[model samples]
Target: MTQLTDTHLYREIHEQPAVLRRLLDKEEATAAALADLIHGRAIDHVVIAARGTSDNAGRYAQYVLGAMNGLSVGLAAPSLFSIYHRPPRFGNALVLGISQSGQSPDIVGVLAEARRQGALTAVLTNRPASPLADQGDVVIDLQAGEERAVAATKTYTAELAAIALISAALSDSAEQRQALAAMPDAVAATLSMNDAIAAAAPRYRYMSRCVVAGRGYNYATAFETALKLKEMTYTIVEPYSSADFLHGPLAMIETGFPVMIIAPAGVMAAEMAEFAHAVRGRQAEVIAISDAAEVLATARVPLRLPAPVPEWLSPITAIVPGQLLAMHLAHARDYDIDAPRGIHKVTETV
Candidate 1:
C-alpha cells in the first residue's frame, strides 16, 4: 500500500483546511470589492464558464448565487464562443470564468467575449497571470498555493470558498460572514474522519458501478464525488440530484446495487433522507455521505461528515471525504493514484 502522505493527491486533500483559511484571510476584501462593483452595475444574471472539477464549483455557484442573491445563474457553453464563431450577448450580465490553472482557451474566450460586449466579468483562479485572468474586470485569486495533483483537491475547495465569499459579501450579512469564517475549522473537523473513510473505502473496492446523489447545493457534491471516483478508481459512477434519481434513474437500483447519498442536515435533508429510504427499500447497498443520522443509518457503508455546516457550504467539506474515498479506493484496487492514467494536471480545452 502506498503511504497516504507520499501521494500529491493525498497531500493536497489534507491541505484543504489551510487552503480555505488562507482564501478567507486574504480574499475577503477582494470578494467584497467585487460585490461592490456588481452592485453598482445593472447586472441581471450570472453566466459561469468552467470545465471538469471547476465546472462542479460552478454548479455550487448556481445554487449559492441564485438562492442567496436572488439572481439567475447559468453555466456557459464555451463552445458557443470557441468552436462556433457566434457568442451570445452578455447584456446586463455578470460573466464569471472559473479555472484552477486559468489556462483553458475556451474559458478565456467566454470571458473575452463577455468583456467585448461590455458585461461585467470576474475570474476565480489560482493562476493570477494566466490568460483567463487577463480578461476579468475583477480577479479573485484562489490562494490555494500550488496544487500538483492532477485530481484537484485543495483548488476545488478554494474555488468554492471564493464563490461563497462573494455570495456572503454580496448579501452583506454578518451571519453569513461568520459562517464563512468558521468553514476552515469545519473542513478540518471533516478531515479528522479520514481514517474512517479510508477504512470504509476497501469495502467498495470490488464495486464497479454506482450512483451518487445529492440535492440543492450538494448536487455539485454528487457530481464532484462521481468525478473523483471515475478519475481515481476508474469506476462507472453517475451523479444525480436526488429528485432526478427518482424521476427515472431509480429503476436501475436493484438488490445490492451501490448508491451513494449526500444528505446533510438542511432544507433538502428530509427529501434526501426519503430518497435514501426508497433506495434502501429497493435493497440497494447504500453508501451515505451525510451529517444526519437518519440518512447515515440507511448506508451499508456510511461516510459521515463530523462537523455541521450550512448546506450552502457543505459541498466544500463534503467533497473531502469523497476525495479521500477515491484515493483510498484506488489504493485498495492497486491503481496509481498520484498519477491517474490518461489525464494531466492541467487540461486546457478550446
Candidate 2:
C-alpha cells in the first residue's frame, strides 16, 4: 500500500525541521524584549501558562530560569489559574504565556487577568497575529512557518528556542548563552538521524505492541513519543517511566513485547540501565536508546548527542528523536502524516 501525502499531518511532519530558519532568527527580538521587560520592571515573580507540548516547554523554562537566576518562576495551567485559582500578586510579576496558536480562550483569559492585575505580559506563539497576542504587551512569534499537522513539531522546537533565549536573557550568565549556541548544532545532529529512523520504521511498524520508557526529563519525551506513535501509526503504544514500568506496567511485558528505553546518559543513567536489565530478565526485547553507551551490546540504540550537557538542556536534544520516530512510523503505516485525527493547529479552550 502506498502512503498518501496530502494530509495536513503528512506535510507538517515531512517538513518539520530542527532549525526552523525564521523562528531561529527571531530569537534575538524575543530575548531582547523579554530581557527589557524583566530588566527594567524590578520583577517580583514569574508565571508561565501553556497547554500540551507548550506546557512542557514552560516547565523547562521555569526550571531553567529559576535555577539559573534565582528568579521565582512558576508553571500554572491557564484554565486553573484564571477559572479556579486566584491570580498571583501582579504588580511586580511577569506573565509568560506559551501556545502554538495564541487563541485559546483559557490562555487568553489567564493573560488578560494577569495584565488586569498589573503583571507585565509576554506571549510566545507561532501566530503573532492571534487574539491572545493582541492581549500581550509583547508578542514573540515562534516563526515556525505553517505547521499543517495537528500535532506540533517545528513549533515545539521553536518554542524551546524562544524560551531558551528568554531564559538566557533574564540571567546575567554567559554560560547559558554558550549552551544555547551549542543546542542548535546538537539538534542538527539529531535531525541527521532521521534517515536512520526511516530505515528502522519497518521493524517498528510490524511490532504487535511497544512500550517507551524513560525517567526524570526524558519521561516527557517518552510520553510525547508514545502520543506520536498512537496518533500516527495507530500503534498500541504505552509510555512509562523506568521506575514505574517495573511496578505495574512491566507485568504486561512478555516475550513478544518490545521496550524502547530513553535513557539519555545524565542524571538517571544508573536507574534506567537497571530497569533495562529487569525488562531483559522478563524475556522481553529491550531496545535502549541513550545519549551515552551504557546498555548491553544487544540492546543498544545509542543516540550520540553533543555530550550530556546540563539536565535542563538534555530535553531539547531528545525531542529530535521523537519527531523522527513519529514521522517515519506514520510514513511506514501509510497514514496521513500532516493533519492527524481530531487535532487543531491552535486549540482555543475556555
Backbone clashes in each candidate structure, one number apiece? 0, 7
Please write out the lDDT profile of model 2 over residues 141-222, one tens digit for every residue. 7877777677787777777777777777777458887877776666666667766767766777776578998777667677
Local distance difference test, per candidate?
Answer: 0.91, 0.73
Q: Quick one: RMSD of model 2?
A: 3.3
Q: How many Å off is the CA of 16 in candidate 1?
A: 0.8
Each model's TM-score, in the order given?
Answer: 0.98, 0.84
lDDT of 2 at 263: 74
Where does candidate 2 have its weakest 10-residue lDDT segment? 10-19
RMSD of each: 0.9, 3.3
What does the lDDT read for residue 128 in candidate 2? 88
